[model samples]
Target: MTETPFKISIPDEKIALLRQKLELTTFPDELEDSGWEYGVPLSDVQRLVARWANGYDWKKHESQLNSELPQFTRDIDAEGHGTLSIHYVHKKSEIAAALPLLFIHGWPGSFLEARKLLPLVTKGSDNFPAFHFVAMSIPGYGFSQSPRTKGFDLAQYAEVANKLMLALGYTEYVTQGGDWGFPITCRIAQIYGGKHSKAWHTNMPIGEAPKSTTEPSLTEKEKAGLERTSWFHRFGGGYLRQQSTQPQTLGYSLSDSPAGLLAWIYEKLVNWSDSYQWEDDEVLTWLSIYWFSRGGPTASLRIYFEAGNHSLGAAFSVPEPRPTIPLGLSQFPKDILVYPKNWTREMGNVVFDADHESGGHFAAYERPEYLADDLRKMFGKGGPAFGVVSGHSGYA
Candidate 1:
């Protein structure tokens, strides 16, 4: 595998085309009193579309992103999946002994999610630890190349990530992720635990309900968590069913219509978080990444299908074996599937856990400081997983 530095330079013609499409957009009618109960409000979409066409400066945000993230591309060889060109943000810490940390993003999110914590995790003080961070654009999302053939399941995503870290000399490293990231990083720990992959952390915890026969009884909080999970599956899971079962069928609309792409993702950004206020420009910038992604916006939705279905197709799930390495978790109250501490013990060798008073699905992006602090406490000098990675103590 070879790595080359990458820069964002979306062609001028693409920008012109986006403007033309925005100008010709035709909107639908909304109920007089309907707001979020129905979906993202029509007012919100109108404002965003106007800004995207006239006011939002893509070049300004594009340049800012390029300057903030030290981007790169590497061709990783995933077994049986052939060679894939991967894009990532690799920011090494000045702390010579900083630990290597791999950050992964989920659906509707890009490597841009890791932007805020890049500076926070680069140095440690007062018993807190620092790290050498590497956040990858999980293939088929962002700028990374998509899989050409089918049957690329959870294990393959893990393989690409593990190999990328090894290519960057990160034979041993810790990880942080949520959403789709939750499962992918877990796969990494299962595949490379006790050897190359060290401790892992996540904000989203998903699992089957604890049956009275096999698992322990659920507490009030755990019961509520189960209800939340159920709520997601009942109302919020329409996208999951489509993406997991027939992603290509829905891809046609997202790929052909830019407005359709915006609405498809913009809804998640609004509802998935804990009432985080989003500026129009901010929304447009995120939307732009998907609209201009390497294989188009729909490419990202297939992970749900591939992961849910077995390696062959009918059964849903690739292997999710428990890892025996030290594991840490950060519980955000408003996260989509918030689970109790006891429930997550089923994940792996549990070491440390933190419960936040606030925050939602996008913990790293919505509450970066809190997430970074939790990580420091988990791997600091007197921390449970401290010195988990050999030679990288994350100290000055």
Candidate 2:
């Protein structure tokens, strides 16, 4: 691994240009019925744009981000294949005793996905100083060089992320992810189980979907959960279809305009945020991370071109289970798709499965206090850390 000479300083000119573009954005005329049907709600977006154009302060958010986290880039050259460049930030916490925790964000989510809640996960006052926080931007997202090719599925991402962790000199660490982060963490646990992979955790894991054959009998509560899951896929999967088939076209629209990018992302923010009334300060704080990194477009579309290509239909196999390593599952209520405890039990040791009373798909973002504390307990117990655990198990 080579050190990539890089910094998180976004030039003043770029910030000014972004604001200018936001100010100049012209909304396309749409019928009342057409509002938000095609994408983000026109009226809601206008409100957000108005605030972004006139009230959002990028420099303030910039200063806060720089002070809270130190950002840098590293290049990992895989044997003879090539080098992959990544951007990462480590929160400056005084607790050297904190367990090493690696956080991975999902599609349309930059490293800043944890921005509002980093302190909750790493600081002392909330509960405990439990983790040495390491946050990273996925390739082609934010400062990290976007993947030059397609097929950057969870397995591929896990490979690169593990390399990145090794490059950072963390022999053992605990990993937590949501959305794409969940699948990526799963691959790491599967491929690098035991001493090399250690223990890992996830919030929104994509486990094997229920088979379509004759209805396997489900308990009453299980049946309710399945019904809810089915409803979400039927109603909300339109976005997935577009993401899988025509990401390039979607990329063109999102990448071209600051307003377009903000609306595209803000939908998830508002919908998934535990706090439904997303304040201006909170909303722009996140948008600024993308705007400064100019990651809004590249990261959003990468998932479409990368994971959409394959792995969606691959048969679900218990990721080469490692008996020695422990796995933690922190399931949140509002998550659209969830893996039952029985499903995760097949892959590895289930140390902890806590179904929280609150929060949604973005657990870390929505309930960092709960997420971080749970992770702290898992790490402090010393069962396993990261995807790599101690000792050779069959999984590794």
Candidate 3:
């Protein structure tokens, strides 16, 4: 597979056209005192849309991303999907013995989620292990080419990830991800573990628990988690229903109107976090990555439809084989579905688990330092997954 250096350079015409779309955009009416109870407030979208069309400097942010991120493109041939030109952020650590770690992102998010953790993970330290980080723009997201044919499911996603690592000469490596990333890497651990996949970790480790008759009682924390899960099923799960069954139909609105797309993703960005302050510029930057992505924002939504095994009206869950690799979880209180710890343990051979008082769905984005530290401890000396990658011990 041939790999090439990649850069983020949106053409002048595309930038101009985005402004045109934003200028001609229309917004929806809002209920008074809505304040996130009724989706994203109209005022937030308006202010962001106006700034997105005006003061927010795409070129400035574009250049900063280009400079800060070391990105590349490579043709990864999935067994049946043919050759796919994949885009990825590849930052090799200064430590020669650093372990290779793949970072994956889910819906409404791109490889940009790994930006903050990049420096922290790759930084050489006296006490902790460093990582050679590789975060791919999962096929249909960011600058990567989306799958041309239908039925490109989790297995295919795992295939692309494993091939990318093998192409980079990492015969064995570990992984970290959340959201759609959670399942994709779990499939990797199931398929490639014991040999190539070594060990894996997630900030969003969720699973179907054992039958009550065979399971232990729930803790107060676990009961609280169930409450959060119920809340999600009521308020935050509409997008899943639509995305799983008819992403193509919904894609039209997201594709045509900048306002529609902004409100759609902006809600999750706010609701998913535990009161994390989101600057308008930061919001726009996150939105811009989708808006300015190669496959368009709509393409990213297809994963929700493709990655699942559920039929319409059935519960939105994709059941997979239990992964046997060493699993480490950094559970956060505000994550979308805070599954009881027992459920996640039933899903894999869990070695380490840590819970935080703060943070949520976007753990890497919302709390980078904490996630980095958890990863360090998990892969550090005497940690459960230490030396899983053979010679690369992540030390000086």
Candidate 3, residue 346: the lDDT equals 70
- Model 1 worst lDDT window (10 residues): 310-319
| Positional deviation of residue 392's Cα in model 2 after best superposition, in angstroms | 18
> What's model 1's TM-score?
0.95
Tell me the whole-model lDDT of each prediction, alpha carbons only.
Answer: 0.84, 0.66, 0.88
Per-residue lDDT tens digits for candidate 2, residues 1-396, read: 665544466777877888788889999766778754566678877887888878877777777777766777888654333676778877645655555567888766778777755776666533333456778787667777666655666667777788877777666666788777766777777776664566778776445644657645655655555665685677656667676667777777776687887887787776554555667677776766666654456555656555635334331234444435677877775676755556545556777777776777777767777887777556544433322333211110
Off by over 4 Å in 1: 212-224, 310-320
As for TM-score, the candidate ahead, 1 or 2, is 1
Clashing pairs in 3: none
lDDT of 3 by residue, 230-265 (tens): 898898989988888888999998888888889999
lDDT of 1 by residue, 317-364 (tens): 124466888888888766777766666666667788787778888888
Per-candidate count of clashing residue pairs (backbone under 3 Å):
1, 15, 0
Question: Candidate 3 overall Cα lDDT vs. reference?
Answer: 0.88
What's the candidate order when arranged by decreasing TM-score? 3, 1, 2
